[model samples]
Target: MSESDPHQSGRGRVTAPARPSGKGGGKGVGEMIAIYDTTLRDGSQSESVQFSVEDKLRIARRLDLLGVDYIEGGWPGANPKDEAFFARAKDLKLERSRLVAFGSTRRAKVKAEDDTVLNALLAAGTGVITIFGKSWPLHVTRALGIAPAENLELIFDSIRHLKARTDQVFFDAEHFFDGFKADPDYAVKALMAARDGGADGLILCDTNGGSLPGEIAAIMRQIALPDVRLGIHCHNDGGLAVANTLAAVECGATQVQGTINGLGERCGNADLTTVVANLLLKMGRHARLGVEGLPRLTGVSRFVDEMCNRSPQKNQPFVGASAFAHKAGVHVAAILKDPVTYEHIDPEQVGNERRILVSEQAGRSNLVHKFREMGILDVDPNDPRLQDLLNELKELEFRGYQFDAAEASFELRVRKALGQLPEYFLEQGFRVIDNRMVRDDGAWIMGAEATVKLVVGGQPVHFVGEGNGPVDALYTVLRRALEWHYPAINTVTLVDYKVRILPQALGGRSGTGSMVRVLIEWRDEERSWGTVGVSEHIIAASYAAIMDALIFKLYKDGATPAV
Candidate 1:
């Protein structure tokens, strides 16, 4: 907050490096820089990271929609899935990002014409090709078992051959910084070889991810010249990929390469999602392409995390769970008066919503803010009921129930305990049974059947259904029970669900008074929302949360439609 520079070229003295021609040239001195992402290639290289062919296609389309300049798919010959992805991506009606296929340069003795990998890359049919060659002498002599002179020939000849097939060829100088440090002459030769070989751009890589930001900037400044466009590819082994990438941009790198959610081998690659957002909104870079719906950043981030089966980092800058989270009494009080006081950027700007964490440290101002978000603007902070709510939060906090991550359930609990929640539906009774079987073919199957009776609008409904889990079976019966009347009910989905057990101390009866907290997230085509429920019985808590989610969806969609 201390510094202010409205110009978009970049913040402070850091400027966008010169880029390869035809990939959108570097903007004016204060113009915003463009971003390129490689989540599909480098990101998926993380051990155990696998994207279904469809998953790869969907993400590539989304990134293109977000206006990224290029999407690096993968090393075609290294994996069957990647090869299939390259083939499938060829047909996408992409308007923004040009699909890029990645691979290493031709082998030591293989001619460009006979190199199997190079031929596979060309057959992938992408207009852009990025091939890496050993820039570090250690890698060339030790890893490749090839002499320095031959490695240079490999670099030059590989680029030369690929150039004839595609005009957009990039040479990724793998381990360029370390290579420059160890043998600056050979490193410079590597870049020079790629340049003469018709490479469209030369990308510097901190392959081992050990270089510091200042070292990266200084080295980049030393090697960058007018003839060759400069780019950067960083890894997060040192937890400084993003910082180093930004510094390289400042020193004169034109293109920035990173992955979504910092996902890659070991620690990860620079998170392109965070990089692009910070560059545009905080650093004042102009997006050359159309990303007017920047709010979708959060949604896309969550969607990718879901597909990867990784929990979203709570404090990941911008899109993490705690990016805009507010706690501490003073901070909450200040934020309630004006969010700008505590929040650096509006969460809504990136498709994220602000969250006021209700905890033991919260004050009446925090309660007022949370109440306002719940659309209860009339709640009096000075009222005794408000004090009671604060006490309840403290009590719950002591019992291991965090409302900050379960806001929906917390809101409903507050209203119900305060006698403010309406009785739109009530459960009469329910029963459940589960079964499992092993087939002769060595396959196993598990199933659950549930029966539930409920009353809505003074009308009783009975339903029964089977499912793969007890919770799922219960949800099915509940939906069937209400489907006839609440016809708009199918629009709801439980995006996220959680369960937590509250601890207690009672010598031998500790579990007697324990609490279970359940959170359910729902989404319609327009927006996403969450609700929670808490009770002693886990199933009861889950059902209560599910009911809250269902009812909330109906209320928002206006089953009546005229309201």
Candidate 2:
């Protein structure tokens, strides 16, 4: 076969795992589910999500490393970027998954052989091709303004044309569940058309994303195709994408189509991170990645989020940061003794860690776990000093210092309490000047300029910086003074910053002097951390957080102070 031949295009093309012949109640590796990732296509449909060809390629490489079975690259003729992506993806050495081209069925009057859509799929040079067609009668008559019979013909001809060129052809029955609910016979006919035309897989899509678990299970059971691979693709419009997907699997669907972090149009698709974890750990079903790939699930989820320039949801199931976090005293006590008492699964199994959040509600157990999380070994958990630290933590929490959201700040305080933290720099003083200026547009604009004096390596240094805000100016000035002694500080940059004002009930004033809390999230090339500061003056509070963030970065990097 030629290099571009569909029969030999993919590096590794794996399909359904064999079903166990003997009826033993063992749910083992025999049930293999092919993971079809459409992050480069469907996920990009999300509002404000526009992945450049390079971004899609990078994500594809990352997904390959994470062991997805099939990667739906994109619709080759849909846009210039997607076409460019397919051309460039050919150069990538993606060794683990089959690359699939996605498109729609042939146009109403267009012949399948000469159809632009089918031709693009073939020209995309992928081993697998997936095309979506209207399964719902409403879409055939109303949306496409075509007769139901003609839509079926489109599905059949489109699949048969692509199947002639590609080794594997997948038919996505768009709105299959809703269509079945509307007209059972017509929906089944649409699926039958694809099957008759030699599609390798039949992917039933919950396009409207309104199907329930029971609905998916009942509909899947009705589609009794012998010797055919059934796939499930769900949307989260009804917040039941994951549930519906699991329901279909229980009803015998073998392939799963989704994005990395539940990213898609509207409410998003079923999160593959959640889906894969549940399949391997809870349901005993297997994906190509299997148990070995489970550990990188969290990393994969976060990698997609990073590519999207979005924050990973901390409360997301399975791989979320707070998935195994404990804050309540009672829960923390039990968790410290036995993690299984609270956590559904070991966090390490998914490349995530358990976090013990410290707050006013926290107890000694919270401190112990927090200490362990920071790798603070040799500390006596029963020591009286530990109680003192807990009391101090509670008092700080009472003063509106949220340690739970700012673990980096908590770690710094705990280290300092143990006399283990090194003082990286001493703040001499800082001044920020806010001025109103008239712009060329005849509008009043506000700007800030800050002067920071700091003693780094025992030498006093001063610097001036300007920005649109006081906090930015301060950070700019401070980073400059510190970077002189710690050049590595340049590697670190601010990721996010948040400020919250305490209410009057929390001992905060109503005016400009109101007590406020600042959270500064920082990131280096390696990892990200957040620090917190609280004070009546916003600038003072911001300075405290910035100082802690800089100190923590330097301390963690093991930078030696010149002093």
Candidate 3:
């Protein structure tokens, strides 16, 4: 190992020179890294990720719009859903991305044309096809029960067969990194076989995802094929997928494959969001996804989560809710002076915003900043009123009120404290009763009824309603009571409802007496807002949140009836 050689060190570690400022030609400042999104395919393999046929279509369109170079639609032969997705994709009007169909290489001793998986890939009607073959000799002998020499033949035969069918064929050398570590000659031979068989690109896969960055770069440098293009596919089992993928790129790999939000099997795959961000912002790569599409990165990440029915990870890098949120007083104060003081990148560059979170740790700067954003702009940063408001917020947070996700509720509280909130209605009282009866056939029937008394527009209004549950019954009666005065209530719809039992320490009690926090998401034709409430009684907490949601809607709409 010589100092002049960047590929090896005295300690047997692989090293690479600093990333070149210019390599693959593009408009950007750094080398171009092709963005290949497998969100619709590999992403759906996550434990909680299940994409409907429609979800696949929507995500494909989104990825195309985001300017990814390729969108892997999934293995068409694996399930009917994937087959249907491909069938439906024929009618899709994609602008930029090339749709690719994924499948394994030809089986042992089988002709590629005779393989059902290969036929399915052709039937998918995609111009591009990606077939993964076992690069590790161990997998060939153990998993496929084939001779190592025959495995190389399978790789060559599969790519040759597919090359005849399509002009663009990508060979995924599965477990390439691990296989290289075990037998470097076999791994290089497997890739060379694919290249010789007309593979346009050979993607080195960290299938087990245990390779370090140094190992990936060192091995990539050792590959002898200089003419064939290289790509990288990394899993996150070791939590180094992103680092390894970037290291491969730094070593001159032209393309990177990953899933949105890192959704995949086991620990998941490299997150395309993080990969693209690091490529463009950190490495200055001229990626297929340019600076223009970067702002929509956050929305794209959330859309995929919505389709998968998974909560967006707040701490996820680049696009998470807490990614740019400042909570500490010192941090908030510095961020107020200059966001770059605490944030690595401008949130708006990624279609996110810097958030000043107000908690017990909040300073006067936090209150002032949040107040201005909420349209309560008259408060001074050093005023006693701001201190009072901060004290109230801390006390409420002590009572399990999380204002981070319920900014509308927090605004209402501040307005009320400042005596700026209008009195829209007064609640007199509300009651709910539940009755259960068993029929002769041993079927149990449960019914709930709720009555609401309120003074709206100086008029006493009483209403009663029945529903499947107490909360529904209460909402029904409340809406009936307010419809005449506030027709806008008809436009408001409850989109989502969530409840969580606060921990005993936060709930200020134990057992059944502990407080339940309710978060309600409401949307009208214009926009959506979330409100939260906490109470020992679930119904009461739900009602409180419901009221807050309604009030927020009315306030936003400037609805001022003579109440």
Task: Give the top-scoring candidate (TM-score).
Answer: 3
List, residue by residue over 315-409, the lDDT tens digit for candidate 1.
Answer: 88888878998888899888877899999989988888888888888888888888888788876678898888788888766655567656656
Q: Which candidate, 1 or 3, would have the higher lDDT against the true structure?
A: 3
In candidate 2, which residue pairs clash? none
- What is the Å distance of residue 37 in model 1 from its true position? 1.4
* Model 1, TM vs. native: 0.79
Per-residue lDDT of 425-529 in model 3, one digit per residue for the tens? 998989999979898999999989999999999999999999888888888888888889888888888888889888898745888888899988888999988
Better candidate by TM-score, 2 or 3:
3
Worst 10 residues of 2 by lDDT: 7-16
**lDDT per model vs. reference:** 0.78, 0.85, 0.85
C-alpha TM-score for every candidate: 0.79, 0.86, 0.91
Stretches > 4 Å off in candidate 3: 1-30, 439-442, 561-563
User: Candidate 2 vs. truth: CA RMSD?
Assistant: 6.8
lDDT of 3 at 315: 96
Provide C-alpha RMSD values for all models, in order.
8.2, 6.8, 5.1
Off by over 4 Å in 2: 1-29, 419-430, 437-469, 472-495, 510-514, 523-528, 550-563
Model 1 deviation from the true structure expressed as Cα RMSD, one decimal place: 8.2
